[model samples]
Target: MNDLEELRDALHTPPGFTPRALDLDAVMTAGGRLRRRRRLATGAGAALAVAALLVGGGQMVGGGAVPDRPGDAPAAARPEVSTPGRPADMLGDPVPTGLPAGTGEYVLYGRTIDDDALPDTTFGMMLAVRGPAGDLTDRVIANEVVGPDTAPGFHAVQGANGPGEPTFGYYVGPATRITAKYSGRTVTAKQARWSADARVIFFWFAPTDGQLKMLTAYDADGKKLPAGHNVVGVG
Candidate 1:
């Protein structure tokens, strides 16, 4: 058909079906159930775990040098396997291809709300640490969920890891920049897309000692946004 005629025909075409309104509460509940089932299958007790650990190295606690720059820590030792370890399946049913972010010592597994088939409105990310040889228990360090808000903000968690591990968390909304001060140094966190939507960003930084201070998030226009409360461990 000619371009003008095709355009006219398209405009007259009937939608194949009626659009149905989504039941947000019901959908959210279903998503929660699915998540709980997955966690049970993995034998993971809580989505978040808090403990002290060295920022770099295979061990979770004590005696590892912190990288001077964020994302520069040495790779954590991977468990030897004749084949890849079974997928944790934490992110989604068919987990995102590139996941488990971080150097080997600690990895972050996550699924953006949209990534879930049922889309858990309260789901965010899980921070995990490697365990002893052949120990498959999920060593979740933090589980931070932002709910279904579009406000540019982040939820941060801190643990008593000796020498301090990286302050980790997830940001939801339209923040393009995230930074914080820890132990008198200004640290900038590395950001990555955690969702198909541009609004969700997962971030972390080089390990720093002491309490995290003035953690801040900024939007594209350079306006500082609200920094959500720093919950002890996970929120």
Candidate 2:
């Protein structure tokens, strides 16, 4: 589904089993009963893992290298093979792609959100900019204040009526309603996962599509922060 749906779903689903220990007999019985499933799952997972490796190395699923799908092919969870910023000694799954490449004032990249917000909303993208464009058509996208730009609150994403432009409704301070719009095709939680770093500014949100999302964040020198101020990281 689209990012909004994914986000909504994540908001509804409650956590399942908590951390616990397994006994030998319990483990043995569970293993025996789940042997076939476990084996099939393992084999399937292995194949997918191999496929991911190949894809990461600039290879495609069927054969030759798969052309980048606007930006959605990588799953935003970091390429399985090799990539910069990916922590070394990372266990099974890769460390997820760090952000996009940019210079001048700021940089933008995609990041994965925690599972709590939205299970399917696994990723978030950010566009870092330093300055504003002369007109709305310019690179920088503007997200109006739902009420305000305050953080640390739950503000459901809404009013992303326009397809190419997505707006964010955030809880500024307390009851303030604020909306931020990014200039790009309709993006979903998965496809729109990007991040910005070092003197960069970013804004993103989801609309109605029921599918995936594809967004691009801009990097501008004017969008950069002060000499020492830290730029917030978003994906």
Candidate 3:
């Protein structure tokens, strides 16, 4: 017999037998619910993958945790520049003549000779009398007797003022004697001593209108050495 004929024969129930109909609407509703659940699960998996990818990309690009706000970034460090007096005004006015032509006026701190005896601090202003190329001296001449309150004496020996050479001069002091020639004339003064091997001559003399009295180099027997330049400091 054919399959359909057999199923019909089997369906032919015995006496007093009955069969119930299937709920087609309920089955269709259960199938729809299963499909909706599958779609929701798939969407949730895709969302989680996308979130993981975004976090990984952020880590790769930023090297670490990302900054949450604009102000979260670290500030850049800066270098410190040391200047005397006002921080705003580091350089001073340019010296007119004595300094090298290109050099300008700036504050100079005095070096401590003996740390045990004196405080390791700036004694006074070392006026940087810079000049044109090859015209300025580099060594600093300081006075032990006078402190920074008194202006240091600066003298440039006329003929001997050369590069890498010792220029003899004097720092104004007590009981120190000075006698020399200037502008083809001899000028004598007491309380001064020879300050050899020094560029800046530290002296305790109050310059008038930024001018020091001109003098020449003298010897022990009152003999004049070479001609020299007398440069003083102002405010």
Instruction: Arrange candidates, best TM-score first.
Output: 1, 3, 2
Best candidate, TM-score = 1
| Runs with alpha carbons beyond 4 Å of true place in candidate 1 | 1-88, 92-105, 111-121, 129-137, 144-151, 159-164, 230-235
Q: Tell me how far candidate 1 lies from the true structure as C-alpha RMSD in angstroms.
A: 19.2
Error (Å) of candidate 2 at residue 50 is 12
For each candidate in the order shown, give its overall lDDT on alpha carbons: 0.46, 0.27, 0.29
Q: What lDDT, from 0 to 1, does candidate 3 have?
A: 0.29
Candidate 3 regions off by >4 Å? 1-176, 179-202, 206-210, 233-235
Each prediction's TM-score versus the true structure: 0.47, 0.18, 0.21
Candidates 1 and 2 compared by lDDT, better number: 1
lDDT string for model 3 (86-180, tens) is: 32212232222222213432112232222111122122222233333323222222222223322333332111212321122334222233444
Per lDDT, what order, best first?
Answer: 1, 3, 2
Error of 2 at 2 (Å): 53
Per-residue lDDT, model 3, residue 194, is 23
Q: Considering every candidate listed, which one attains the maximal lDDT? A: 1
**What would the TM-score be for candidate 3 when compared with the true structure?**
0.21
